[model samples]
Structures are given as C-alpha cells and as structure tokens.
Target: MDEIVVGIDVGTTKVCTLVGRVEEDNSIRIIGVGIEPSEGIKKGAIVDLGAAAQAIANSVERAEHTSGVEITSALVSLASANVASVNSRGKVGVSGGIVDDYDVIRALEDARTIAIPGDRELIHVIQRGFVVDGQDGVRAPIGMHGYRLEVEAHIITALAASVENLRQSVASAGVEVAQFVLNPLASAEVVLTETDRQMGCVVCDIGGGTTDLAIYVDGDVWHTMVLAVGGNHVTTDIAHGLRLPIAQAEEIKKQYGHAIRAEVGLEEYFTIRPFGEDEPVQINRQELAHIIEARVEEIFSLTLQEIKRSGYDGLLPAGMILTGGTSALPGIRKLASKVMGMPVRTAKPENLVGLVDRLDSPAYSTSVGLLHWALSMSAQDLAPPRRRRMKGESNMNLDAIKNFFKRLLP
Candidate 1:
C-alpha cells in the first residue's frame, strides 16, 4: 500500500490542511488541500481557544471531503513568538572503542540535558555536526574508530502553555497531533536546496503576523527566531493611514501595494471608499507603496538585527530564500535585498502534482513542506540495519527504538 501523509498549517491568516500520497519514485502527490481564513489567532498564537478549534475543524473537514480520506493524525506547523533556541554540546565515551548509533544518540541526549525554565517546552534538537575523539567537524561519527564522541546540537523550545493550547485546538478537530514542527523548519524542507544549505543561507518566511527566520550553515540549522511583526502590520498601516477598513486595506495592499515606492508610477491610481467618505476616492499607487515600503523596510531591518545578533550575519553568503504569503507582494524580494544587502529570491511549492493548482503560491510553502517532512520521517523509520544493536541491550522493541532515535534527529 502506498504511504499516506498529512500536514496541517495553522497560521495567523489561514489554516491549511493537505493530504499527500507517496509514489514509487519517492515523490509526493498532493491529493487533498483545505484552506480557510483564520480567526482568533494573533501573531501565530491562539487567542480564542474555541474559535481556533472551530477554524481548524473546518479546514480538516474540507480536506477530508475533498480527498475521501478520514483524517486521524497529522504533523502540525508551529510559529509562535514565544519560540527561542540555544546551542549546546555533548560528549560520550564510545562503547567497545568504536563510535556507533548508540554512541551518537548518547551524545545528543547529553546535549539535550541543558537547563531550561519550567514553562519552556522542548521542540527540536537538531544535530549541527559531530566530532570524534580529537577530530572535529565529523559529519557522521558512526562506524569510526574513536574512544570519545562529541555532538553539537541546536535546541529549540517554546512556551508550554502555547504548545498545549495548539494541541488542544488540533484535538478538538478530531486529529491527533503526531508532532509539532517549527514553521520555518517545515518550510525549509520544500524551498531550500542542498547547495543552499551547504553554502550557508537563511530561510525567511514572512507570513501574515510573524516573520519566521532560520539560519542554515553546514547543511544544518544553526539559528532560529520568530519576530512578532509580519505582512499584516503593513496592512494595518494602510488601514490607519488611509482611514479605510481593515478588510479594504488588505485588499488594496494586495492589489496595488509595492515594497519600493519609487518603483511605482506616480500617475497609477486606485479607487477605495474610506470609512468617512460618502463615495469612492482616488488613491495613488505611489501613496500605497509609500505606506508599504515603510513597514516592509522595518521588517527587514528587524530581520537584519536578528541575523547580526545570531553572530551568523557574516556567514550567509548564499543570501536568503524568501517564502510565505507576504513574500508575494510586488518588489518584496528587491526591497529585502536592498535592506538586508544580500541576494534574495522568492520561492514557492514547485513541481507538484494532483490538486495543486492553488498551492503554487509562496503562501502554501509550509503546508506543502509538512508533507515532505512526513516523508523524510517515514523513510528514517523504514531504513535498514534496524536489527543491529549493542551487545548489552537486546530488550528494546522495534517501536521503542524507532521513537527513541527519531527524537534524537531533527
């Protein structure tokens, strides 16, 4: 039987659910998609539990109706402002004078034993690299002759309350939360290339209420952060500046907004009925662009500050790969490049098949990337050499080992 994978992306602006089928050649066919406008979510956190749960349930129902598959459990995407990360190192003595899977796992386990607050919940422990004995920069320590093994890991955590709230929302929709994958990490699975990772790059996903940042160096995650501002801030600016309704402001921003004001012609205009106006008024495209440029520039400025704070600012030679709904704005890439002083490119879900007509935009990167994450996880579980074990331990069951080691990896 073909493997089935599901992913749910609950964002500030929308909730998306996707059902995918794994093909013989390891490609995924997206058989189902459900996208609905969000409510009771602010800056990627749930504000109203009932409303958030209802929104998620609606999205799930739509996906189930479209795909004819009963949804039970799925990997969900998370993007809360409470997200934070740290770097730690661990070392372990190699059993039997040789580094093996268990040795590597032990090192990672040790690295994960850092001091965390009572309210913080551990999310991910990604292996940055490994060092065997006196040797450093060892990509894989398995099978190498070494007495000691050390591993460097990047640990991500969030507020325990926020995580439980999200979990409850998904549960209310009748779906079990298989795992919670960070937003930018999930999006990275689809938009990033192997060369991009090895050469050092950042994945900047600017969604409605949050700008998710993930720095990848040496083919591994090095830093991650979530800024509390996003595209919706620009819309809010427009709403206040033009005295228009929030809905109308968002519409105008999407239709006429440009990241760079000078790039827009002064003569170009659009009509909108502001809150106090009796009839429609003519608004210059340049005027709208001006409002957008201010907010957009601030967004990148904040992003630049974060990159520098991570101390990896000088490391991103490959520049940034931009994705998410807000990235679709006109001239955002150009503006981001100018603000950050790096090469920027906008990306989306590509080379997709089956019910993917509406998913080609950058907005669905997280939704599509979730399926890819699931595929990778499934591959790891089905890998060979599963029977190999250390001489002392023979009591571990297959499921126990699978769960234990899977948590050790990303």
Candidate 2:
C-alpha cells in the first residue's frame, strides 16, 4: 500500500483541495482536485468561522467525490497578512565529535529559542546553512566529525489567534489540521527552482486579497512579506472608477483588464452595463487599460519598495517570478518588469505526476503546492531508520491505510 496525502488551500476568494499518493518511486500521483467559492474571508483572514467552514466543507466534499476517499486531515496553506519573519542564529558544541540528525534537530531548536512576541507562534524555522567548526556553507553536516555546530535560519512567525481560527474552521469542516504552511513558502516550493533561488529571485503571489512576496538568495528564503492588497483591490478600483457594480467590475476586469497600456488599442471599446442603470455605457479600451495600468503599476511599485525595504533588491539577479490568480491578467509580467526594472515572468507549480491539465493554472499553484508540502512533511516524519511496525497491527488499520492510498492513486 502507498501513503496518501491531502492539501487544502483556504484563500480569500476560494478554497481548493488536492489529494495524491506517494508512489514507490517517490513521485506524487494526483487523483483528486476540488474548488469552491470562498466566503467570510477578508484580507486573507477568517472573519466568519461558519462561512469559512462551509466553504471548506464544500471543497472537501467535491474532492472526496472525485477521488472516492474520505479525507480526515490535510496540510493547509495560510496567506494571512498577520504573518511575519525574522532571522536568527544558533550554535552548539558537538559533544560526540560527530554531527547527526539529532544534532541538526538540536541546532534548529536552539535557533528557535529566540524570544518572540507572546501573540506570535513560530511557523517555520528554515535552516539556511550549517557551519561545522570553522568550515562554512555546509549544507548537511550530518555524519561529519566536528567539535562545534552552528546554524543560521529564518524564523517565520504568525499571530496565534489567526492561526487558531484557521485551524478551528478546518476542524469545523470535519478535517484535522495536519500542518499549517505559510502560503508564500508553499508557492515557492512549487514555482521556484534551485537555480532561481541560488541566483537570487523574488516570488510574488498576487492572490485575491493579499500579495505575498518571498525573496530567495543563495537557495535560502531570505525575506517574506504580505501586502494587504491584491487582485480584489484592482476589481474594486474598476468598480469605483467605472461606477459599476462590484460583480460587473470584476467581470469586466477579467474580460478586458490589461496591465500594460500599450496592449490595448485606442480604437477598441467595451460596454459595461452598470447595475441599477437602464442603459449600457460604452468605454474605450484605452480608458479601461489606463485604470488597470495605474493599479497594477501601483502594486508593482509597492512590491519594488518592499524588496528595497527588505534589502533584497540588488540580490535578485534572476528577477521575479509572479504567480497567483492575478498574475494571469494580461500584460502583468510586462508591467512588473517595467516598474521593478528587472526581468519578470509568470510561474506555474511544478512536480506533479498526474492531473497536469487540472493543476496548470496560476490560480491553483498554492493549492497544488500544499500537496507537495504534505508529502514533504510525511517524508520528514518518516525519515530513514525511524519506520517501525506495531506489534499488534490489525486488519482494520491496514484497511484504513489502504483505503487512504486508493483514494490518492491516479
């Protein structure tokens, strides 16, 4: 029997679920996928528990039907603006003169001991690098002989209340929260390459209610930030500027919004039928383009300032990789490049062995990445030499594990 894993992405605009099985060859075969319109979420934070739970339940039900499996737990992706990150360092003496898994874990724990605010909980303690004695840049010092060990890591923190609310919502949907992954971190796992990270890159996920930014350098996540602005704000802008209803503005933005003014012709025109108005109003493509360009440019400009504030602008030689629903907007990459003064390209999630057609879009990257995160967590939990069989294993247990695997087999 194989191991099954599930991933759930709870976003401001939607909830998505994905299920997959880990094959013998260590590849993931996706077997189920689902999405539902989101509610009770504002700026990536849960405002109404009941509404969020309902949305999650809807998405999970759809996935269960498609995959024919009862999912009880999942690795969830979180995109709240309440998340934050800081750098910390730790060092310890290698008593046995040998570095091992225990040493590594201890070093990480030591790094995590730094004082954080009472309201914050550590989300991730990513090991940047290890220094064995005086030698630096040791990716894995395990099994090496050294008298001292030092570790540099980034400690990501988030508001405990916000995280607890998310967990509660998932629990209300009848699913256990196996893990809570930071949204940008999960997106990076799928969209970023080793080369890109080594060369220095920024991953910008323009979500429905928040824009998540993660900057990587030398294959390490150096900085992360979430802006309380995203594609939804663009929609609101269109709604206000054109005097149209929010729904109509959103539709128009999806159908006609272009981030670069040059992409739209002055002669081209589109009609927006405002709600409560008897007649449809005609608007030039250039006019709509101008509105979109202004907002998108503002977003890019702010992103650039964030990079500068993070002190990672000069480090990003590979430029930026834009993902998320908003990245799908026409001409966004061009506008980002022009404003950031660096090369920019749209990114899609990677490393899936099945369901390529269903998981190819930027809108689903974070959800798909959540699946990858689950697999990674499972792998870490079952690291080599730790697999033990229970003495009284029963048929029921076997059936449960098998059923779980069957649901994930593509």
Model 1: colliding residue pairs: none
lDDT of 2 by residue, 14-55 (tens): 999988888897778888888899989998999999999999
Candidate 1 lDDT, 167-204, residue by residue in tens: 99999999998888899999998999999999999999
The alpha-carbon lDDT assigned to residue 24 of candidate 1 equals: 93
Candidate 1: misplaced stretches above 4 Å? 382-410
Cα deviation at 330, candidate 1, in Å, is 0.6
Q: Give the TM-score (vs. native) of candidate 2.
A: 0.91
Model 1 worst lDDT run, 10 consecutive residues: 401-410
**Prediction-by-prediction clash tally:** 0, 0
